[model samples]
Target: MTKCLGLVAVLAALGFATQASANQDVQTLASDPANWAIQSGDYSGHRYSKLDQINASNVGDLRVAWTFSTGVLRGHEGGPLVIGDVMYLVTPFPNVVMALDLAHEQKILWKYQPKQDPFAAAVMCCDTVDRGVQYAEGKILVHTADTSLIALDAKTGMEIWKVKEDDPKNGASGTGAPLVVKDKVIVGVSGGEFGVRCYITAYDLNSGHRVWRAYSMGPDADMLIDPDKTTSLGKPVGKDSSLKTWNGDQWKIGGGPVWGYMAFDPALNLVYYGSGNPSTWNPVQRAGPGGKRIDQKWSQTIFARDADTGIAKWVYQMTPFDEWDYDGVNEPILTDLDIDGVKRKALTHFDRNGFGYTLDRVTGELLVAEKFEPDVNWATKVVTDKSDPQYGRPLINKKFSPFETGTDDVTKGICPSSMGAKNQQPAAYSPLTSLFYVPVTRLCMDMEAFKVSYQVGQPYVGATLTMFPAPGENGNTGAFIAWDGAKGKTVWSKPERFAVWSGALTTAGGIVFYGTLEGYLKAVDQKTGKELFKFKTPSGIVGNPMTYMHDGKQYVAVLSGVGGWAGIGLAAGLTDPEDGSGAVGGFASLSSYTGLGGTLTVFALP
Candidate 1:
């Protein structure tokens, strides 16, 4: 009897040890400081982590623990969200929602698939993929490809409610990530190429009810006569308003799609977003009736609108009557910069026009506008007060022809291609290093503009753009630039053969995480741009990197699949048609890896 009692006591002690270990795993995920709210670390849009367990010194020792492939194919740009011990991610095409249980060895808890329309593929100008989903109010909000917004229960992945935000007949969809502020889910409509007028809408989190809507172009009342009267914001002054800049109802069909990332400041109660370029490749098609020439306002502008009311607080137009396809749809990063001796809350954006701009978030004042590239000929310098550059204006010479706009010429190479310095990829702002890490494509384009007219359902304009090596540069690839926002200078840079399609993420450990078009996930020093670590995934990594703590370990996660615009172009050139029969030249390669599908891989320290 004594021996039996002693054995029972030993078994009880072992049971207590197992329970303690289980509790420790939960604590690691719950108390992790690196995983926080929103994109980056907070509302500031700084994608910097405060955890040092995976610092630059120890990053070299990192290894992959697991990978989750959705097999959805197409482009994989969705960045995953880590909350508690669960991981949430979005897939391409139909924009499926997935939840994974981290404590149970990264097992998928549930998957929510949205009903997508097959005809929607024909309207998508680029690839059919979403950047990511937003987590707010105990629910995961995902914008579907069918123009519907669905809310999922965070724990069960069950549909809480689904709301259709746009008319399917108008060719409107949601490809960009949804931004959640308090109870409002702010989202924008995409499908500019299909002649759809764009708009931004906000919805309630609890009820999935729309709060307010703001159109990119003014209504018929404002476009024809008084511009201010058409919009929610009152009229503009004299000739400065966008209405006076245009001629006779041309503003009615002007395109300014808000198909990019948005940032918000709770302190100021402002949600800022950048607008896309005008419709059609040709300005002649959008020019005023009878021969009147007018400059369209707000097409390529950064607007700061009230979060709750959808009222325009201030707008800084980057390119006023933009003849080039220079869409200002890049991510707008919010930060506080020390300009001269004054500390100002500034908004930083690396525009597609090859210029990096710093503006006062509160007043929309241009703080610093400088060219980050060497061969930016379109603009000599950005005006401090106004957003216009010093160079690149259209000249109306009859010799140019009715078919050709004077600005479009193959010989007169554009400084930055339509891809610009940075495209849709998100940049990282590290508060620890006081720097912004940007992945820039160092390439130029030979552009010949053509006269374009807006018709109901046909191609409106024509321009030929051929990618070339940067001026005095030999390669046609990309570079990782460490920009010091405080000093407005390039601290360090690393070049590559292919553009860095993936966005960047910085950690408190002084390491920056990003992926390359060549299928390598890399970790670099935030200050020196030194390559500390790298891991090759299934395919090229185009998505952003995110970090989360699970089971007492820090895990790094990213998606790997090749199907975006750049990926399709590169694959067409690299893969021979003979090698793969029945493959179309340009975007045909996008379907090659379509079967390989999309994947979300996670890594942890062993």
Candidate 2:
């Protein structure tokens, strides 16, 4: 049951070897704009397609082509994977994978239902939404809600191999998508709020053999940190970086969850990912300078590791001594840009700390950091070394710091609330316009930190927060903005009544597509941010949008449901007026607009 080695042998004995097709290769995935071969649409994490069949010039004529209801309604967060003429979709909770024949009016070719444990529902920190699945070597790789990593045949719904990746009993689950690199299938664990010391593991794609595992905490050996070699900002981390930063083996339970997206550069042979916040939001309990340090080292940090060996190559801490739970787990989007005339390989990320960063992906050097949201007050600005100028660090304004409220006191009037200017939703980058399309919410929070004791299988969170929109924002809750990453500024923004919770999709057609929390799917001009088209769906959308070419026509598709931390109060009808914090009451307005829905909607030109 726990990543069985013999099960793979049995599968191999049954002639379950992966079948490779010409289009399944990595080169085809990088160049083919008609097929979404991998999650994030070809690994650059651009979420942009080159198919210009649905251009902005005639976008107003777009119409719904077909729809499929998942039947089980809940929060849906990820989009589908389209390969050849088949589109693969994964649902929430039960973690069902359905193969839709695109050429035949979206016929359901096959469906795979794994044996999922019901207890996983209680362990998930957010709604029961699986990000998505990956397709490689003729196999469909899925990470279930119950911590299981499975591979199924693409042509059929046959199970090839299954491995238990996380322990739900220990407050660990798997909601993230699997990333396949060549013959290795990489997956990360979730549950930072449960005091889970997270990790990333790789398995053989052909046979489910566990390769190497790397932890986010513990000693240097466990973290795979070669201090003398692992550099950050052009300097070495020395030795025992992870252990020296913790107090008395506290690193064992120190939370640094990996619940978000990851990117890889085959040329650099490094995989990029960001670690989540430390356990127990109460800084009084988790903060300790064990060795000569003054705070936790790696919590809320970004790491670059050798893809094959799982060894740390470079790391950069975004929030040192994190007191506000601004998770550094946002997607590290990789791209190349011309900065001040020099073209450099950059990793663009919209951090929860309210800053959009452009870093040198090769050496982990910070290039530019600026606010994407105007209401950010947790930090004055992101500054760099006085001598080097390139070694940037956040100049946290203590006047607005959450710690100013005292150890056991409540902090009020913090801008860009605990949900952050952005959360788990991913942004997109278009090579045609060279602009990053970002989905963000504008809000502030009132937080109160309390002491908490660590207990297995129980919540380790020690803070309660009440979130509401920022002051004087004209009652607008969210906006989809086109960001100029090179200039570190916003190009244009489209305001919405609710937070834009869905991922964006930009096409060569000069159109950007996104969904709103109030259930409206809209398309706008990629250049001017002018509304080109809008349609009301059945429910709020938290999933990402995707596009594919089938029958020589481009189709846009997205999953819609009314569930996530943002809409939890609505979907569950949780009207806890006297809740510990006023968060439930503050967000109760969402229910009035939209409720629960789980359906896959596809649109195309008639």
Candidate 3:
């Protein structure tokens, strides 16, 4: 007994349980494709694995290896994490964390499920989705729907440290996964519709001490922005940047919720993320200059900030004076590309505003900006000329603009519903194919703008919308497309009956995998976008698909649960055809196909 005790103590002293030695372990594991270490797979947010054991030719032979039930309802947005011989899974609300031993007959090694107030679900905007979990060193990180971030022992499932990040009762909750960057874990808050000010906070990984908190929109100090240092369009953003954009203390509730995938660049020591839509979705209520560009400074913008100090490096506003509720909370994929005979570092982003943008991740230079959806008509194009005073702003078509049409008027046939061309479903970039596999929502809407007064922690949205499939596209509502980010072109597209809500996975096998709202896990040719193999899941899949290798066999896994905006119309019995408050009545057709469920399916070549 004395000898065993000393051995355990020696192991702990040798980079076993301490947080200071955690970064190197995570970095090494993340560098490996055999283990899906982080939420984005790697810091680049590529979601592409380098394992080629299950190639495109053999992917069609994939059979069910095993399955597990999360036993929770609502949407599951993120995927699972696999490290060594264990698989970690997290649920939606009560946020149950399960560590399953893969070596054995998939035994439950340990489970960590929290008990909390059921009323915490009220603060959630949509389907009460938890993006998933993160693992680093020997700890599993979880962000709960009730505004809590927890770290647990990877081996024993014991609580290492837990912190209350926000007040769910006060209308601020975090649904996305927390990202671990070196010695810190970063989290972004969500409350755009609740009129609550949002920010991204980073904490010390070891002691759970708050390191920095940067607001989405506020004064320079609160935002942690350097007046003459942080820049846009290659020029300094002067003082009062966010303050001058709003009227009076409106910036207090300025809704720039950074509640989505954030990618980091270790070489540059910068982290990149986008903010959500501004408060009071009604354009008329958020007053601005009529003919000029309303610089809602950081909302609907991409921000590159110093990971350690939380100082803004640069920013690019995707939508200036956004009249539509296009939250710019999608992932920014980092990679190097040769653009127009010049080899440059590129950061590609698919915005909720129906445009795919590629910029220099290092310098924040706009290299390519084009409409991934051919029918997108919100704005003709993004102005990319740096010299133009109108640079980085969209050339709006006033006919579809709610702001231009004035209050109480309904704007008709605005392509790309407030959901944008896509929501938080992440796109996968294959460095092998030089193409991005994107899951698209071909949705459009008719929005009516009105007046609304903001009250503390209350819903401040002032718009009513009715959604439908984009016109002239048969009756299909979604598609899987292969895009060339350097050229801003779609190489191939395959239409889907419903929105392709799952996150995409592209492996060295040359196959792109994603799930459909009809409960099918599909594999398509990475080169041609041809459906090669597909299997019906237990329910509609809104979660991301992930790939990992254990015991020399490649395994692909995905979570299936139908409760996002597209399926919530059925899950919650919402009957209004024009309902657009998170539950889209346009997707009522899903009632005939799927219902509420939560299951994880794994596949491997037989």
Candidate 4:
């Protein structure tokens, strides 16, 4: 099971590596607003659309325009890829890719399913999930559950070229979507819970050639970091940047499975992504001599790298010596914000650590970091201004620090839980409203960490915990809120009885749409958190909402199937409410609300 293929894709750090030569066709298609040409819809990672035919004023009149079933009953995360008259969709394990003829009443034009090892699904930390696909250079890029990155002809669904990015034997899997940076397809894997060293690799988009691969933690050459030129918080990080902080070779199995969404800046020639958490959730096991915190270098960090060379420009580590398994791998929404009368290129992120951070994307300067959830108690506040010596660090509350309490000390009343304030359910940024619509979990946990050894292809997690709704907000488990990243403040909040595990989508129509675990797709006013429309889908939803223009009409689409970490109990047919560690124990009520289902429900005005 210990397949040493060499990688270090640790969790959510928002590293930067974007379009090198600029795929002109994808650039034009994404710019036209007629097609969702990329996995994140655009490089900005806004998850927002310009189509407004179905505005808030008439969204109530919207009806089901079309629907298609993937025939796979598992969690559906990302939305479909609608490029012109063709639409592309992917499913959970044994990854299946289907090209649908949008003009021909949603006819199945072609389908390609990979024959994968069943063991891949068996070893996943949570449940099997593939975040759809990405499109570039007339090819559909697929990151399969078995760690295979393949390219299929967009029109025929025929295999163009394929590469084994990582071996499943080592517990490596690719759940997040691959990103196309010009001619290079950048990919990251998820297996942090399996205790595998992780990294991001860039392959040529057309030829499937390995361009450059960078590890999350290790030697400077291995990470492609320039000791003198590469920086941390605007200062150069000298040689042995990663090795110095780690205790011996512990960084080798230190999980860096960065399986989250990525963003790019064409002008900066940078690719952005977040790395995963360190391995062995028990901080006591990862401690240095004399019980000092092991600052596992590069894990739980955000990075900006030169797209072509894959060298780090700058990096900022959040949740250093992480004790709560807070991965830095959230979606980094890039936008230009005028802060203090100065227009700055900004990247805003809603972290699993329960903080909304906005940083200067160009220089990696810390701009704003504030708790989106008021009840978040792990940290008091982040020092935002560079003037302070403690800038960019969260002031930890020792009362909730698992590492502080040591091994076997059951830490109670930790807000946000290890599920974080949010999961992969991405938020949306609307320029019109200048706000971020976030769909998030509102649960607290009681956790106990024990020493655990790293075993490849097996869960290396050392924490066992149970979850319940957080205190305040009437004991609700989820909420949809509007946030102003520029000011690091919440604009409004709307509570949900269950977790809002679905992604949010905002449109020029002035509405933000998100789905609830109860199967209700709710469209609300963008400015205010007022509900505008709600429709029940066939099952609970964990998919992101997307919009596209077809035949001069605007349409919105989302996939409904409940089987992510939050719905693993029903999807995996597990009777134990405590299965998946505590996932079932936390979200066991979801089984009573909806059963397993897999269907794409598209909405449009009649």
Candidate 5:
């Protein structure tokens, strides 16, 4: 008995030692910028992977390692979180969380499905898929479909706690991925299209306690005040001046949903998020009487807020009084670049308004603003001096204008469809190659406006956007372009049959990875944009691709299934469906592929 007791203690001690060593290794990997520690890969939000095990030279030998289907049929846009040998993913609708053992033939260690309210689906502007999950402080945090944030034991998939972000009766939900920095879990609210006041909030990871809340539209006095008591962006206005830009206190309920993934610079301590358009598709409703103040304070703007205090550092409004539903809620990628002659840290965005912008990360100054889209009639040019558009504002009563015409039809032929050339799907930058790889569409939209009315829960504004082929462009196809970030010039371009809906992933091996809407996952030459390798999946692929090494073997993974704005539009014939929509086609086809289902496909060297 004594011998047995001693042996048991020895085994226990060995287990402890192994756990400690494993934890230390994880800490080392997590802290390294080369391992993609943040959402966009090391706070720069570049979405570029540094490891280069699978280079363009050897990409042809890449084969599927394994595939895990979530069995949930909605749109799958969530990117996978690869930490060590375990990969974490979030699914749509029920918002189930799954942890897979990548080293063990993609074995599912555990799956977590948080209880969600069914009615929440009604408020989602897009599909119900959660963008991704955050890993911090030994916990995995995810936002559910019903506006609830749940923290789970990363290894066990057990729920630690849950926090509700909205009152179900008021109609608000969350679909974007939460950003975890230090001990705070930062998340933005969705449901702005449904007329809810949108805001971003931070919660304590340890206790699930609310730290601070910053509303997208609110009284100046109520905006997030710097707890440090610093006079940052000046004092908040009391009454009339605060509401001057907006008519009739509409600012109180104006919609500016921060629904897309946001990036952060820990060094600068600034959190950057692009705000959506104001409530009511009609600008006439929000902008009453006179134009008053030209640019709305923060709506449709790229906001730089103090990461710790939630105070506005600086804001650059992308569009003034956005009426075309071209919300600026795209990925704000952070990266360091050499602009012209000087080296500077920058935040770049491929805005939905048909322009790409590079701004000084610290001060929010526009450095370069150029049009990347083929056809953009709404805006003649983006004024870099003022960080505003020179010719995009719609006049209230002008003839032939989108607003006064009240023609909500596609034949009118507007350039750069609402989806923009690039949408929420993030692009990736390869420091090794010094080029930015993005999936761009060459489609146009004909938009007609409608008069809007302010209502609590109803869609006030109306706009019908019809997708058309670009002028002189062939089909509604997409192209993968490698852009010189510093020079703002196209390095290379490759035409694709369908839009590249997923985000790009560039590795150290000079390879750029992306998935197409038609379910083909391919690797392209990072420098030349040459298609080096390709593989087909069951359904269309829209989720971002992630690369990680497991058990000394590097693997690339992406979620497959189609159902976002672009996916829905293509499926429903809103745009020209590359798959040739069945004879009687319309928007009804948007929900047609629900049976297509969601899947997680992983690849590795044969």
Candidate 6:
């Protein structure tokens, strides 16, 4: 008995029960296609895996290996983390964490469930959707809907540390995943509609102590902007960049939430993320000059900050004086591309504003920008000239500018609904083909601007929108397209009956995988855009797909659920009219296809 006890202690000390060591050289394993260690698969946010065992030739033989019901009836938007013999899965709302032993008939290792406030659900703008959790240094990190950042022992599922990052009572909730960059666990909040002053906070991975805090809208100090040092368009942000942009104390209620995934550059030591739109979609109430004011300095912009210290490196506003709710919260993918015979380090982003931008990652230089879809009439192009460096201004169609249109009531037939062309769903980059596969919506809306006053923690939006399919698109509402970011061109596109609401996954097997609002997990040939395989999932899929190898076999997994802004009206059973709050009448078609559900499905070549 004494010898057995001593052996057990030694095993615990060695972290044998955990099965996977987060201490493993992360940089090495992260790049490995056989292992999925990070949320976006790797720091680059490419969402591309190098595994070819499940290549295009044999993809048609794929079959379901297993499926697990999360038992949480909400949208699931992120994939699982498979490390060695164990897999970690996180569900919505209650934020339950489950560990599965993959080696033995999917044995349940342990589960960690948190007791959460039910009120948080009511405050969430959309159905509670948790992007995912992170694992590092023998701990699993998760951001809860009730505004808590928690760390759990990977082996025992015991709580290691928990910290309150946001207050749900004040209309702030957390749905974005926490990113672990070395010793820092970075998190952000979601409340653009709730009027909560949002910020991104980083905590020490070991102690859970706050290291730095950066607000999305505030003075230079609170925003961590250095007047002479922080810059955008190769120019300094100047004194009080964020403060000068707003009227009075409006910046306090300004809505610039960080509710999406972030990408990191280890070599540059910088992390990049985009902020949400300004408060009250009606820009008339927010005041400020229309175009080229630089006052909307930080909101609706892409920020580059020092990963270690949270100091601003540079920024680029995708939408200036955001009249449309075009939040720049999509994932910014990093890659190297050859443009005009020169290899350039490129950061490609697909904005909700219907434009695909490719910029120099290191210097924040705008290289190429183009409308990704033909229905994008709001902005003709992005203007980055030296004299008028309105990142996305000068090109915003004057006819669609809600502020310029003199009509007090409704500006009819605006292409690309307030939801923009894409939401939080991530695109994929395939190094093998040098193309990006994007899932985008072809939705347009008729919007009416109104007057509203801000009240703390209450919905401050001042707009009524009615959405519908873009005209002249053959009644199709979405498409999956292959883009050449280096040249700002679309290679090929395949239309879908509904919005393509899934994060894209590309593989060395020459296949691109994604999910649909109608419950189909599909794989298309990476080079030819031909449908190779698809499986009907249990529910609509708004989640990302990931690939990993266990026991020498490649496996693909994805979260299947339906509850984003696109389907919120249906999932929540709201009685909105044909032209009401969320345009539930516009999205009524989704009800015929799939309802709310939460399931994790895995597939492998049989």
Give per-model TM-scores.
Answer: 0.85, 0.93, 0.95, 0.96, 0.86, 0.93
Q: How would you encode candidate 4's per-residue C-alpha lDDT over 368-446 as one tens digit per residue?
A: 8999988799999998868889888889999998988878889999988888898888999999988999998988888
Which regions of candidate 3 are displaced past 4 Å? Answer: 1-22, 289-293, 580-583
**Candidate 2 lDDT over residue span 115-223, tens digit each:** 9779988888867889999888789999998889999999998999999987888999888898887678888888888888888888998888998888887777888
Record all residue pairs in model 6 with backbone atoms less than 3 Å apart, i.e. clashing: 245-295
Q: Cα lDDT of all candidates, in order?
A: 0.70, 0.83, 0.87, 0.87, 0.70, 0.85
Candidate number with greatest lDDT:
4
> Model 5, range 1-606, lDDT digits (tens) per residue?
999889867866654322232224333555553344445554556777667778878999998878888988767886877777677888887888888876687789999988877888766766666788888767889988788989999989988989999954455778888887656788988766667778888898788899878876666545563323322122232333335667767776777888788876655667789888777665545656664333454577777878667876766677677756678888888777899789878887888776778888777667777766656667666655443444223222232235444444333555566566777788888888777788886666556555555555555445555565567655645778887666666778888765567888888888988988778899988877788999988778888888777667787888888766657644233444322111112123333333265888888888
lDDT agreement of model 4 with the native:
0.87
Clashing pairs in 5: 44-334, 52-509
lDDT per residue as tens, model 3, 1-606: 999999878866653543333367777898888899988888889999999998878888999999999888778779899998999989888789999999997899999987666877777777778898888778899988777889999999999999998887777877988999888999999988888789999988887899999998889999999999998877889998998898778778788888899998776778999999988798777776554446677898899989889999998889877889899989999998989999987899998888999999888889889999887998999888878887777899988999878889889899898878988899999988899989999989888888888776577889888888898889898999999999999999999999888889999889999999989999999999999999999899999999999999999999999877677775556788865473456786887887888999999999
Q: What does the lDDT read for residue 149 in candidate 1?
A: 84
Worst 10 residues of 5 by lDDT: 578-587
Clashing pairs in 1: 40-47, 49-508, 73-597, 228-235, 285-452, 408-449
Candidate 5 structure, TM-score to reference: 0.86
Model 5: per-residue Cα lDDT at residue 148: 92
Residues 1-606 of candidate 1: C-alpha lDDT, one tens digit per residue = 999888867865654322222123222433356454454445556777776778888899998888888867777885888887777888877677888887797788999888777766545655677888877757888887767888889889888998997754566667888887756888888766555667788898789888888766665323222334222122242333665566666565666777788887766778889888777656666666664455577678788877777877777767656656778788889987889899998999888877788888877767777777767776666655433443223232233232243544443456666667787888889988778999887666655666555565444435555655577655645888899765567889898766677988898889999987767789999879999999878877888888876656787888988756566543334354211111123223344433244677777776
Off by over 4 Å in 5: 1-28, 31-37, 225-242, 291-294, 386-401, 404-411, 452-455, 569-595
Clashes (N, CA, C under 3 Å) per candidate: 6, 0, 0, 36, 2, 1
Question: Which lDDT tens digits does candidate 6 get at residues 1-606?
Answer: 999999977886754632222224555567677778888988889888989999889998999999999998878888899888889989988889999999987788999988788888877876788899888878989999898999999999999999998778888998998888878889998898878888999899999999999998888999999999988877787898888878778788888989889998776778899999888788677766553324465788888889878998988888877888898888899999997788998899999999899888887888888889789888787875656645535376878877775325787778788877888899999999999999999988878888877776788888888888999888888899999999999999999988888999999899999999888999999888999999989999989999999999999999998877776765677667543354586677888889888998999998
How far is 11's C-alpha from truth in model 1 (Å)? 57
Q: Provide the RMSD of all predictions against the true structure, rounded to 1 decimal.
A: 11.0, 6.9, 5.9, 6.9, 8.5, 6.9
Model 2 has an lDDT value of 0.83
